[model samples]
Target: MCSLFRCSSASSLLLAFGMAVVTASPVVMSIPISAQNAVPTLLTSTSKTTFSDIKANYWARPFIQAIVERNIIDGFADGTFRPDRPVKRAEFAVMLQKAFEQKRVRQLNAGGFKDVPPNYWAASAIKEAYETGFMPGYPANLFLPKQQVGKFEAIAALANGLGLTATAPASNILNGSYTDAPIIPNYAADAVAAATQANLVVNYPNVKKLDPLEPLTRASAAALLYQALVWQERVEPLPSNLKTANYIVADVNQNNQTPNDVVTVTASDSSFSILSSLLKTAGLAVILQHPNNSMTIFAPTDEAFANLPKGTLEWLQQPENRETLIRVLTYHVVPRKRQVSELSEGKLKTFAGKAVNIQVNSLTHQTTVNNAKILQSNIQASNGIIHAINQVLIPPNINLSKK
Candidate 1:
C-alpha cells in the first residue's frame, strides 16, 4: 500500500514510480547532483589541435592526463607534462569553466577581481568561478595569479565550484582532537571542512593536520579532483566478489534498551554468548522486542562471535569500556529494514552513518562486503528482520556497506 515518487529539481520533473516486486515496496529517490544514476558527459575539447606523443609527468601526471583525456586541458611540445608545476590562476579558471560547462552547471560571472582585469584572457571563466562561489579573491579583490596555490585553497575552490556544501560539525565525527581548524586561514576553512566531509581527505605522511598554506602537489591535485568527482556522485560499482553478511534486528530504544520480548537462542543452538553479554552491557535488552516493524540487524552468528580472539570478549566485559562497546554494537545496526532484494551494487550509506560497498553475484546467490560474505538471509522477527551471518561483521574502523 505504498508508492514511489521523485521530484527532480522542478515540478516538471516529478514522476510516480512503480513498486519494486522483490522488496514489495515503493522506492522514491530523487537524483542528487551525482553520477550514480547518470554520469555527466564532458567534451574532449582541448586547446591543442594535435599534440605530439607525450607522457604526462608525475605529481601532475594523473590530473593533467585526466584533463587531457577528458579534453578539458592540454600540454605543450616536448611531450612531457610537468605536473609538479604550480597551476596558474588563469589555468585554474579555464579548467573550472570547462568543468562547469561540461556538466551544464549554471554559469558564474566574475564580479571583478582586481588583478584579473577584464582585459585579461579567460576573464569570463575566472569570473564564473568566483560568481559560482567556487573561488573568491582576497578581501580587497586581488587575484594573486602568480602565487602558487596551496592544498587547502585548491580544495576549497573545487568544493565550492562543484556545489558541494559543508555540513555542520557532526556530533560523533572523531577529529582525533584535531586543532588545525583554528590554524586554517579563514578564507580556506569553509573549503577544508567541505572537502573533509566529502571524504576527500587522503592526508598522508601528515595525517593529523591539513597544512592549508603549503603548495599542493600534483598527485594531491589528482586525488582531490577524483574525490570531488566522487562527491558529485560520479562513481563506480562495488566488486562482485565482495562478501556481505546479514544483520539481526536488535531494535533498541533511544536508551539502548532491547525490546520487552526476547528470543533466547539456546547455548546449543548458538556458540558465542557475546550477544547476551554485549546486549546486557550495552543496556539494550529492553528495546529488541516483538513487533519491530521497521528495523534490520546484521546479526553475527554464535560461531562467528566465538571466532574472536580468546581474550576479546573478556576484554569487552570490563565495565570501563561501556561506551566503546555501545558504539561497536550500534555500528552493526542500520535504521532501515533492508531486504536482500533491495540491495544494489555500489557503495551505500549505512544507517550507522558510515558507508559500505556491496556487490552481489547472481550466479552464486551471495552478497559480499569489501570481501566478507553473507552466509544467511532474512530471519524475521515481529519487531524487525534479522539476517544471521557467519563472521562477526565488525564495522570497519572507517564504516560499513549497506545495500
Candidate 2:
C-alpha cells in the first residue's frame, strides 16, 4: 500500500521526489489522501547535444546550436552540418512548423499546391504554413517545393510569419543600411526593412554587402531563425560582435563625422580624389567600407593618374572596361591591416587573390610595394592603415592597351 502526505510548504520537494503532495494548513494536520488512483509524473532528459562539423569559431555556430538544442533543426545523416549547402522551400516549411506554433485559420479539402501531393511527407506542413500566413503559393496554385529560396524571400517569409510591420519609411531604412539597397524589389522593401530593424540580417566577410539574390544557405537560415526566436521573446539573446547588430541606427549619424574606412578617407582627401573615383567606378569602395573587414591600401595620388600614358586612365574609366578596372584597383589593396613598423621584406597577398612582393630598405627606412615607391607612410584609418605611393601597381596578367 502507498501513502500520501498533505503538506503545503513541502509541495515542490515532494514533486521533485516523484511524489504528489497537496496544500494544507501550516499547523501540520495530517489529512488522508488517495494514492491508489494517482498517476506518477516522469522527468524528461535535458542533456545538450553537439554537432560534429560545427566548431567553436564558426560564424553561425551559436545560431546553429540554438536551433539544434530546441529540436527545431538537425544535422545530416552523415553526422555533419553542411552549413554552406542551399535549403529548399519544402525543407524550410518543415523547419518553420517545428519552430513555431500556428492556429489553423481554415481547412482545405486538397493540398494547397498542385505540386505537393497528399502523400508527400511535407504536405501537411506546407498546407499549415500557407493557411497560417507564413508562406504564399506561387502562380497557378503551384508551390515550387524543390526550388532553392533566396535571401530576400527568407527574410520576407520571417517578417510575414511574425506579422511584423515597418514603422519607419522603407527607403530610409534600406538605403541607410545596405550598399545594394537600390536592387531590393519594391514588394519586398518593407519586409526587408522590418527584418533589418529587428536585427535579423547577417552577412559574412562584409556585413554591408547584402547580396539579396544569392541562394539562402543552411547556416544563414539557422541564423535568421534564431534571431526570429529572439524577436518573439522565445530565446535569450547571445552576446557577440559578429552578429551585425544595430547597423542602421549606428550609421545614421556617420554623415557628419569623418568615416574611418580607407574608401571614405580617400574620397575626402584632395590628393587621392582620382583613386577614389576609380574605386567607386569599379564597385570596390563597398568592400573597403565593410565594417568587419580590415585591410591596408596603397593609395596613389592624383599626380600618379596624370602620369598614366595619355588616355590610359580615361580608357579604364569607360563602362566597357569595368572588369579590367576592378582587377587593376584590387591589385593595390592588401587583405590584412599592417603598419609601417611591422613591415618586412616578403610576399604579401593582395585583395585581387594574387601575391605582391614588399621590399624594405633598412638603411633609409624606405618601403616599396610591387614596383611603386611609398611617398608617405602610416596614414591611419578606422578599418586599416594606408600609405601613399608614387605610382600605380599593375598586376602582371593585365595587358593595358594604349588608346
Candidate 3:
C-alpha cells in the first residue's frame, strides 16, 4: 500500500492514503483500485477542462485546450497552464507516451535508464517513450528526467518518432527557410527540415526565426504536438492566420506587399534584369503588372540569357522579330500560380497557348520545365509565383536549333 502511494504528489497521496487507511480491509486492494484510482480523475471525465490563466485570445490556447480535451496533458493543481514555462524531459516523455501508441523496434530490457528508478513518477512513461522511439536518453545510459528540453530536440523527437525523413537536401531546405539556419545543429537539420515540410513547425512572434536551442515552452510544445496530431490525421489543422502553417521564406521583393504582384516583384530582383527588360520590350509587362493578374512566371537569370548563342538576343530584339519574341516569352508564363507543393510530373499549358513538359523528381524534390531546371522556387507574389529557371523556355514556333 505504501509503495502504491510512494510516487504520487504529496497532496494527492495525503488525500488518497487517508481515505484508504480509514477503509483498510483484511484483503489487499487490487492495482487499479489502489494505484490507478488513487491518481487524479481528469482522464476519466469526458468534459473539457479550462485553465484560469489560459484565455481564449492566447496564441496557443486552442492547442492547449485541444491536448487537454484529449487527456494528453493537464494543467497545474492551481489551475494554471503556465504556457511560458519550460517543459521538463520527464513531463515531455509522459506527454509523448499518452499522445502516441508504442511501436517498439527492439525488445525491452529489465532496467531501462540509470536514473529512472521503478517507483519514480515518470518511470513508466520514460520507458514507454524510449521503447516507442519518441525519446532517447543521454550518453552513458543516463536519463536526465529533470533536464529542460530544447526546441530542436522536441522537433527531432517528433520527426523521429513519426518516421519522417527529409525528401530534399537539408541545406537546401534550411538555407532559404529560416534566418537562423546556420545555428541549427548538424545532426538535427534533416529532422527539422522534415518537420518544416510537414508544417509541424509553428513559431510565435517571428515565423522565420527558428530558435532551435531555446528552451521548449509549454505553449510552443502544445502547438508542435498539435501539428503532429494533424500530421497523423488525428485532428484538423487550426484555421487561424496566427498559426505558422507554412515555411516563411525570406521576402526578396522590395515592395513587400501582403500578396506581392509577381512581375513587379520579379523585376525588383537584380538577377532577373534581363528577363525584366525582355518583358518590357515584349509589351507583356502590362499584362503581368496588372493588380488582378494571377500567373506563374519561369523567369530565367541574366546568366541564362548570356549563355544564348552570340547575337541571338540581338536578333530577338529586332522590330520584325517582335511577334516571335512574344511567343518565346509567353511560353514561360503559366495562367495560374502554382507553388512548389502543387507541382507534379505532367504537362501544363502556358500563356502562349502551348503546353510545356514539367518533370518532378519525388526523391530530391527537384522540378524541371522543358530543358530548363528550376533553380530557386516558391517565390511568392500577389499576382503569381516566380520560379527562377536556369534556361529560358522557348515556344516550338521560335526555333533556335541552328543557333
Candidate maximizing lDDT: 3
Top candidate on TM-score is 3
After superposition, the stretches of candidate 3 with alpha carbons farther than 4 Å from their true spots are 1-49, 240-403
Candidate 1 per-residue lDDT, tens place, 152-259, comes to 788778766654433233221213313365566766665556556555654544455666667765445545655555333343212234221011101112123232
Q: Tell me the lDDT of candidate 2.
A: 0.68
Question: Model 2 over residues 165-194: C-alpha lDDT tens digits?
Answer: 543577887888788988888899988887
- Candidate 1 — which residues are off by over 4 angstroms? 1-65, 101-111, 168-174, 177-182, 204-209, 235-403
> Each prediction's Cα lDDT score?
0.48, 0.68, 0.70
lDDT of 3 by residue, 190-306 (tens): 888877766688777777888999999888888888787765546766765744343222322222333346666677789999888888887777556665445678899999999
- Alpha-carbon RMSD, each predicted model: 19.5, 27.3, 19.1
What is candidate 3's CA lDDT for residue 365?
Answer: 59
- Residue-level lDDT for 160 in candidate 3: 78
Error of 3 at 375 (Å): 31
